[model samples]
Target: MANKIISQRISPHLWFEHQAEEAAKFYTSIFPNSSIGRISHYTEAGHEIHGMPAGSVLTVEFTLDGQTFIALNGGPLFKFNEAISFLVNCQTQEEIDYYWDKLRAGGDPKADQCGWLKDKFGLSWQVAPVQIAEMLVDKDQERLSRVMNAVFRMKKLDLKAIEAAYGEPVGAK
Candidate 1:
């Protein structure tokens, strides 16, 4: 299982003060193509920690968007802030809306097209599309300026409004 583990994994570990397993399940349910993989506790059927009953979960591995994550029930040495975030590259407006609303279900948006928001777990994420970056650097200066102006004031990236700002076809330059 060593080779198999290394070959298909980029796991971002989360250290939860408590409820690592609960958080794992929460995340898996929210994201598409995700689920709980493995859950192991401190007190096994025939084992113990520090010669006492440490009945908490030692580790919980979860899969989200085909990516693996391991949450440890470590003591609260640190907590998640906005220091690290995940970027979701969306292809369509519908895709953008779905993730934006859901991911930010209990979170708030930051500034501009570079959308930043926190989940219920206080984990930050940036939900954007390739088109957004593309639009900003469009060949038409007027279109570029207008789109840039609009995004500077928006919490969520609006595709239709961006297109309207152009008022003409702007090639991806």
Candidate 2:
């Protein structure tokens, strides 16, 4: 069989200490239209550099919500930080709560801020309502400020609270 071409222009690559497969499985389970793809193992050909067993897992390919990603067992040379994160744009409070609960499992509680959380593997994720983006970009500066303030005070975003903030009197707390 011939090689299949990847249509996506760019795909995110995650480097894990040893949980590439596990992370892939966990991520695939959380999102709709998600699935695990090809998995590749380390071979002795590059064992001198990789230092992994010949049959050890090297990489796992997975898809989440139509976006492709690759997870590699690259050891502890690097770690995930808040500098980058996956943003889940939810349409309702239920969606936000669902994603927040699922992704925040085994995550750092202290990292929960403004709808952002660091998962068990230290991956940062943002679970916020789709309207939040529109609110942020609204031409009404006062409303925008209110929405931002409300957002900053939340760990897991509450769409109702955010909407209230946006609709309240400009000077009202």
Candidate 3:
């Protein structure tokens, strides 16, 4: 068969010590329209540089919510940090709660703040309401401040609380 050209301009690549396949599977399971794509194994040809045993999983290509991603078993040379995070924009409280609960499982509870959580894989994710973007950019400074304050007070975002804050008058307790 002919080669399939990748239509995605850019794909996120995840580096894991040894759980590339596992992580891909976990993420694919959580997101709709997701699936595992390709699997590539290491060979003895580059054993010196890669250090992985021959026939070991080297990379796994997966898709999450229609976005393609590559997971590489690159060993402990690097680690995931909060410098980069995936923002999951949810349309409802249920959506936000679902993603927050699923992604935050076995994650660092302390790292959770303002809808941000570090998952079991050390990957940071922002589970937030889709309307938050508009709320933050609202023309009213007081409304924006209230919304931001509400956000700062919660780990898993509560859409109702945020909307209440947005509707509150300035200086109203």
Using TM-score as the yardstick, the better of models 1 and 3 is 3
The C-alpha local distance difference test score for the whole of candidate 3 amounts to: 0.89
lDDT of each: 0.72, 0.89, 0.89
User: What tens-digit string does per-residue lDDT give for candidate 1 at 120-158?
Assistant: 766787887667777776677987788878776667777
User: Which stretches of model 1 miss by more than 4 angstroms?
Assistant: 1-6, 43-53, 108-114, 136-144, 166-173
Ordered from best to worst TM-score, the candidate numbers read: 3, 2, 1
Give the alpha carbon lDDT tens digit for every residue of 48-135 in model 2. Answer: 8878888989988888998999899988889999999999999988999899999999999999999999999999999988877767
Instruction: Select the stronger candidate by lDDT from 2 and 3.
Output: 3
Give candidate 1's error at residue 169 in angstroms: 5.6
Model 1 C-alpha lDDT versus the unseen true structure: 0.72
Worst 10 residues of 2 by lDDT: 1-10
Q: Please report the candidate that would top lDDT against the real structure.
A: 3
Clash statistics: count for each candidate: 0, 0, 0
Looking at model 1, residue 93 earns an lDDT score of 82
Error of 3 at 118 (Å): 0.7
What TM-score would every model get versus the actual structure?
0.74, 0.92, 0.93
- List RMSD in Å for every model shown: 4.5, 3.6, 3.7
Tell me how far the alpha carbon of residue 89 in candidate 2 is from the true structure, in angstroms, after superposition.
Answer: 0.5
